[model samples]
Target chain A: MSNFNLKVPTMASMMANGETPEILFWVGCAGSYDERAQRVTQAFAKILNHVGIKYAVLGTDESCTGDPAKRAGNEFLFQMQAMQAIETLNGYKVTKIVTACPHCFNTIKNEYPQLGGNYQVIHHTQLIADLVADGKLKTKDNKVFKGKRITYHDPCYLGRGNNVYEAPRFALEALDADLVELKRCKQNGLCCGAGGAQMFKEPEKGTKDINIERMEDVKESNASIVAVGCPFCMTMLSDGVKNIDNLSHTAVLDIAELTALSNNL
Target chain B: MAIIAQILFLLAFISAVTLFYKNFKKILRNIQLGKSISRNDNKKLRWLMVLKVAFGQSKLAAKPIAALMHFFIYAGFIIINIEVLEIIIDGLLGTHRIFLFLGGFYNFLIGSFEFLALLVLFAVFVFLARRLVLKLKRFSGAEMTAWPKKDATIILLTEVVLMFAFLIMNASDHQLQKLGQAHYPIAGWFPVSQYLQVVLPTSAQALVFLERFCWWLHIMGIFAFLNYLPYSKHLHIILAFPTTWYARLNNLATLDNMATVTNEVKAMLDTSLVPPTASENATFGANDVHALHQIQLLNAYTCTECGRCTEVCPANITGKLLSPRKIMMDTRDRLVEVGQNIDRNGNDYVDGKSLLGNYISYEEIWACTSCNACVQACPINIDPLSIIIDLRRYAVMEQSQAPNSLNNMFANIENNGAPWKYAAADRLNWANNLSN
Candidate 1:
């Protein structure tokens, strides 16, 4: 399998243009771990800072959001973890929070209410899209790349759980990448088979591997590079690219990474 | 014609029809979808079930004592048609127990029916024991947060008293004509009434008056019971046949198709997707009771209050705050609230508070797994799973509020080629690994 690492960005930006933001960023698990995700989170934060949105990050204290536990049916672990996250977020007086992990984003935004944790949460792509629309993240890189064909995979956590479909698409479009549609595009998008604890346990019973199935859909487009919004999908799909030698040339990069790459960062 | 007999004959026949009609309307409106009981379908299973349950008494026989008790009651009640015919001809028309042919056999049949009535009385004592003393879970009350054991006790006692009274009236009359009051052959066989016979005067006037009084009480008690049926466990008595009949044909837990309110989502509005709740009624699935159509209500009326649905429900078992029975009751409670609202201002049901929201919280709405176990367990063929799914559809499509996973899941569906938000260019990458 192909390999990629997830690393998160810094929160040095939110106040660049002098705007007090309503929420804070909690760069999620995959962002902290994946190299490409780290760059995206950091660059997005820089863009937000450039745009003047005030924010804070929970820093080292940020841990795994309880989504993994809940999906695994260990609801007790999910509750405990969620309560801990909520208590930490509350300490920051954070009314709104943002994360790059689709699973984290889902847990913080959607499922946390079950544990009495209520806060307005948005995925990082949504914040980036907003910042771009507000003209904080200049699309100077948009004019440079002429023929960089790319496709996206819907990580179940981000795709099905949070419903942040368009924001990343808008971000990708804004980044000057050639967008190609997949046959099973949107809604019917097959699972990377990573959500609902499939990432941890053995998959129930499908012939093909989950991420392999997802990557195959992406490879069918023959896109030179694939853009991903969620880090877990990045790791799984990136690894999925290596199974076929000829498909070896295909590269999986985060939407953030693609944006950062286009920016000459 | 005797005035009493003429009045009773009309009342009994009319009362049965009236009770049948009321229940029939509910099933027609709720389950049949504009059709009454059989719009045209195979009834072999229904036939088999009727033969097994109604005649063979298989369902009752499974619980021997309860079966014996029920057997007495139903058998007594069924054969009592003989007594009814006798009353119409001999008692009402003043014909003196005369048979043109097979007089011995006819008398023997009457005697057998009279004996069965006494056995029926003895059997009812067992039914009372089951309904009151043992308190089966199937007979739990509407909420079942607590089982009200007393109400069932009273109803069972009343049935026994009234039915035995009818038998006493028949037995005493038969004795006067066939055996004489002194010998008391038929009355002697009935221990409860025979003891009372000893205390009363041996005069024919007293015998007639007692018979008349007992006859009036029996018939009136029957009418009162009919009216009380829809409101009590006795509703099951009327509902059981159709429930069993439908259960024989339809898979109760299998949900009906949801009314498609999403309009197939014609154009992908990426930047400006319409809010999910854009149905003409601003509804998806079952936003309101009428959104439920008729079969849903049939599910409500047909519920046996057995708690089998509740016990098998994974959501309830998982501590998710949803029970299949509670879902049914929520529908019931919603119907009541909406019904009251519609009554107050016809077609203004839209303004009232949601009865579903009060009991079936939004969290509870989404917790359901759509498993059909509850459907499978329902003896009446009520499908709670369908109702739950419809409500979930309403919550998602119309309400625009859904469980977190659901919202993102739909988003993923709308966007990242799957429920996952991966880039489209990556779709074929996985094919690289598999040997073509």
Candidate 2:
């Protein structure tokens, strides 16, 4: 996977050259460390690079957006992390942010304004949709996923949480593939069981895991590829498919990965 | 005899209204027990939410069959009550069909009321069947066990009896008018209830007695139902409007930031800045009902107990102990208990129990994924997720108790700037082999 030499720019590197990128690519905690999620980060970064979009990653300067802490009821810790991230972002005079993680996208877009760190934050799917709409990213020649059955799982934070339901679907629609919808999609989408800090702790006693129940919807959809926009959903849905029987055919791919693969970026 | 009858009617009306007012005052006081938060901004948007959600029954559209049935009941409850005005005037003035002056318009009004009553009866039957026969999963939960279960049945049965009384009253009245009874007037039309005229006795005296009996039952039932609103989940009929109006306009992803915590953290970051002083016994989050915001208390009162929140809840669907409906029910129950405590002991007295552990168990609150499905499913915008977060706050901040895994995650966030324990310098390792 590392054989491909892709150009990735950092905010510090851009600053040293007296350059300001068009947007800041916020490679979130999952995108930075988690091996599986890092692929999504690279895929999205590949799309940005291919599109000739000037974007810079915060790299080591970026910290956790404190969504998990806030949701887990550690307000003090959340504010501490948020304040530090806000100060760093403000210091760089950053105004526009794009991230592959819905959790980071949501926390920055909605919750940051209250703490005096305001910016034009968008999910990477939204940015990708715009790029396709502007004709910067061409999907017309794409044949890799043209006839494949793809179902999109709406990430809770991106869909019901902030009403960004169409952007990801629009990106998937560009693949020229047979885009199917899960039984529970858009506003009524079910959780992938990795939210509210549940990703950190073991779920309380239950007859089944929430992800397994969501996987049932995926099974019902019968789509060969399950497209997700959030890193957390990617991990949860992947684990779900592996755990469930007769689901090995289903590949959980992020919207960015699908787009990048289809475009041969 | 007519004077005595009027006096009795006046006495009943005054007492029913007075008792309802007293109970309503107690509810207001109980809500006042909660901490204050400003939901007063954006008045125009708030009113729009009230109209769209409460009056329009917009959110109920998620389940079309249930929404249509509820619309029938809601419309019947509002429109049929106009006939009650005529009944009250007739009782006081010893007049028969005082609205007869409206001529054909009175007939049109009464006809519409009769039609609505029939629809209400049909809707009630369907609702009853859904609960008892069909056994909808949404209607059955651990919280819907005894009193909550009976409460729903009782309200439906009450509606059935009241609707029957209304129709029979119209039928007997129609029969009396045909007999040329002295006090009977040929006034309103009966469309649906006209069929019931066949059930009436032929004798004028018998018809008069039956008419009077049904009329009294219908009026008395309305009064009883009014007073029952305070104790029953039926209170949503009144509270839904205000609850929708005060709903959070912000995106569901935005959890409210604690200003006090921000101040404390600011002081920690900058030594020169002084943190705001807290009360001697200030708590981080809601351990008791009084610690919650007033709107959150209103949300408890407005919960219809339809179990829609619990039905859509991931935690509950996965067979976890957490049910969002139970959270609202427990909050209301605790508030009621605290209200009773205040009435028994003085206002300052504590019950030595709280909402967190006393009613909602740690296992239940801990199971939530905070996915906002429960929040989205609430028809009237009642926020069970907010209450769950507050309870979690009490557990984490006030008690310093959390799952061991969460403790490790928290430590990682503090030390490594991410939830996972990875060195900050290596965050860019994903881009190591990339070409510039």
Model 2 chain B: ten consecutive residues of lowest lDDT: B274-283
**What TM-score does chain B alone reach in each candidate, compared with the true chain B?**
0.70, 0.98
Per-residue lDDT of model 2, residues B1-436, tens digit only: 9889889998999999999999999999999999988888999999999999999999999999999999999999999888999888887787778999999999999999999999999999999999999988889878888899899999999999999999999999888887788888787899888899877788888888999999999999999999999999999999999999999999998898998888888899999988768445678988899999999999999998998899889999999999999999999999999999999998998878999999999899889988899899999999999999999999999998888999999999999999999999999999877532
> What is each predicted model's overall lDDT from 0 to 1?
0.58, 0.92
What's each prediction's TM-score?
0.50, 0.99
Off by over 4 Å in 2: A1-4, B278-280
lDDT, residue B29, candidate 2: 96
Error of 2 at A26 (Å): 0.6
Off by over 4 Å in 1: A1-265, B1-102, B111-124, B135-142, B145-151, B178-203, B244-256, B259-282, B317-321, B329-351, B413-436
**TM-score top scorer:** 2
In terms of lDDT, the poorest run of 10 residues in model 1 chain B is: B253-262
